[model samples]
Target: MTDSPNSATAAVTLVSGPAGTGSIDDFELFYARRALGRFRARLGRQGLLDLLAADIDEGNAFLRESARASDGGYTGGTTVLSTQGLGAGEFVAWMDKAFADENVLLAAQPEHYLMVGQANGSVHVVENVGPHICSFYLGDWAAEAMAWADDADELLPKADFPYKKATNLFLADGTIVGRVLIQFGETDDGFTSSLTVYLPASCPQDVLDHHLRHFAVEFRNWITAAAAARA
Candidate 1:
């Protein structure tokens, strides 16, 4: 595991599940390593938003930075969410649908180990063997759609959107790891978004799962906070 230069308080651990062993127990073991903690952001909220709102390549620079720090492969590209904004409940429903969607997996032989589909939100966990990667993403259908759009089109129209927020976290089990949280929303000005990252190069599937769940819970709270701030 390596420590992230951006976050002195955070560390990233590299881990791999039992190789060539695919069983229900192994699946369970993989996810059992889930852990969580918060880390300081490398850049302020406005700065991160500037990066995301910048040209397409720069917009995704944060993900690449995360990939480098974690020493793990990451999903490239952006996903622009749907036009239909969602209420909190609808957001949860969208997450359930997204978790059920099979296309979210990568080229690797992914084993869908655990799935948490709740009325408030959803989390999909998978182990990607070929690249030795484990990833968990939390967001609703609208958020997913937005991510896809950003991934598909680099120079997306951002004039309609403003405000972005991101935060960093230090995740640990036996050792510390890097994790990131990112959120993008609409504002009258430019764009609003947030992001957090945890480190070494790789972390266990369960560890990632834990962070994913953390994001879901915090996201609901963020909705309330964001709304309150706007009001």
Candidate 2:
């Protein structure tokens, strides 16, 4: 367990588990099972597949690029952060809005997302993780995620898991390089979030570690921004 650099009013603890071991397909399947099970249960088998297919069609530029770049390998880590006075719902809304504004996104994690520029509907982000300027489909799966969070059935209630959002990363040329999956659960005083970053398996250990730290730093700052918005 390690603490990332944070503001005086924010407490963000990051615990990085072992790097994922497997081919890129294995990595994708692992996360799909963990993150999409509830959606499957709610959407039914065929419905879930349809939703996924639609999402892929809408924003698969990165997927196309990743296939060309990753060479059948991938690595990633999850960082868990617990903080006070911010609910999962509030943070999710703020995050969605922040992505639309390059300034807000960069402000939240300047150390990691050094620069953010608009390219078509996606954002081209320059980060400390690598030398390339990455392109990300910020709203990828966002609508579906919000819908899932809002629709709570008797079998799977919202009280159990409050919010979730998944988006992807790509190179400027459209090759997929990484992904981000965030799940947030409400706590007594605030919330706990699991921030996961997936990179091509060939990424160095230091780069993977830096990404975990990057998640910690950016999210801590975003929590502060969300709190200020509420005020």
Candidate 3:
């Protein structure tokens, strides 16, 4: 991946959005990404999914209420990479085994989750590019969105990109507020990731600005956590 001059820090930019036509633009977004250094061993597809899925319990204060499964279990709420090569039943069995035997590096950090959900059911977001709280409900969409990323290579062939993850944002009341998409590219040392947050065109200017700062904070923390895990 090509590096941006500001990549070292938490720099966010408005890659795409609406032009204030008064009509709603569903695909407005701000984007940011960074390349964390390589590790002794890189996280495989399943490992990466495990780390992201752990966010509900491990994510910072920003994540609010997460959706629960029908069985009343914490779904962990992140999608797996494409199950392209394996059969459906085989993929299911593999996932079962993978979860049962968590990664060694990940298992070592029992207290720290890749990301954590708030116990108080409030979204704590960071403003001014620092850590704070913002309540966003992540449910089953987490899985579906990430699955889309896994299939992006085939779906958006013209884009010619691969290894991506995505998810929509919602409030506790179930109002769809925004969406996030992260693209991953391998590097000699490790990998680089680009993240984008899409909001509705009807959103206010201040809210959009705040989300830019929000992206800066959360992704920076996440990258740090990921680096630690790989180390």
Candidate 4:
């Protein structure tokens, strides 16, 4: 922790007092630790969408459109979501069919995570992890990794996504050892359309491995399933 004459103390600060951080997004994930979390498959598409909709600010429009309708604020805010995990390509195809968008961008990434865009104002942000699609709690994995990455860095960069890094590692069970970032971006068959998934290099090893495995399996299944149905 260093201090300077020209900044907000040159140290990390918490925003949980008087104003409750005003906006949940205000909380800076100065460091996030990664841990071994679990994932389970949900019953159906709607089931998964419901879970993703939780905790999201509603004014974004995509959530509103997907979950039926809403008042336009709590149900419409910027709803950037992280999937438990998914195959980069398969998830996009699902979005293409589900939203019936002729121009959807689905990106397959190295860490078994996928990023899809529901930018049309009335679309879905869905990812199909294997049967373990429920939830993979990165434990404080991403958090701790973020901190380690922070101290080692001569710089402090923002995720440019809904996620962030924070401190507070030391999980009760066992301490997570390591983590990293994987980036994936893709465009539709048309070339001018796209979606980008920027996962910071702040995550642990096993957790990262799981996503890689998850992506490989689920993505293949997604493609196979789609082909089977078509045939």
Candidate number of the best lDDT: 2
* Per-model TM values vs. the true structure: 0.26, 0.58, 0.37, 0.25
In Å, residue 107's CA in model 2 sits off its true spot by 1.6
Please provide, for model 3 over 49-77, each residue's C-alpha lDDT reduced to its tens digit, 9 standing for 90 to 100: 45455343333223332222112111111
lDDT of 1 by residue, 61-170 (tens): 33344455666433222223322233433333343344454332211112232234435443433332222233343344343344333443232244533233222221
Model 1 is weakest, by summed lDDT over 10 consecutive residues, at 167-176
Candidate 2 on 23-63: residue-level lDDT in tens?
Answer: 55456656765554445357653463354454434334434
Compared with the true structure, all predictions reach lDDT values of: 0.35, 0.60, 0.37, 0.30
Could you tell me which 10 consecutive residues in candidate 2 have the lowest summed lDDT?
148-157
Winning candidate number (TM-score): 2
Q: For model 3, what is the error of residue 9's alpha carbon versus the real structure, in angstroms, after optimal superposition?
A: 20
Cand. 1 Cα-lDDT = 0.35
For model 1 the local lDDT of residue 114 reads: 27
Q: Identify the superior model by lDDT, candidate 2 or candidate 3.
A: 2
Residue 156 of model 4, lDDT score:
23
Please identify which of the two predictions, 2 or 4, would achieve the higher TM-score against the true structure. 2
Clashes of each: 48, 5, 14, 40
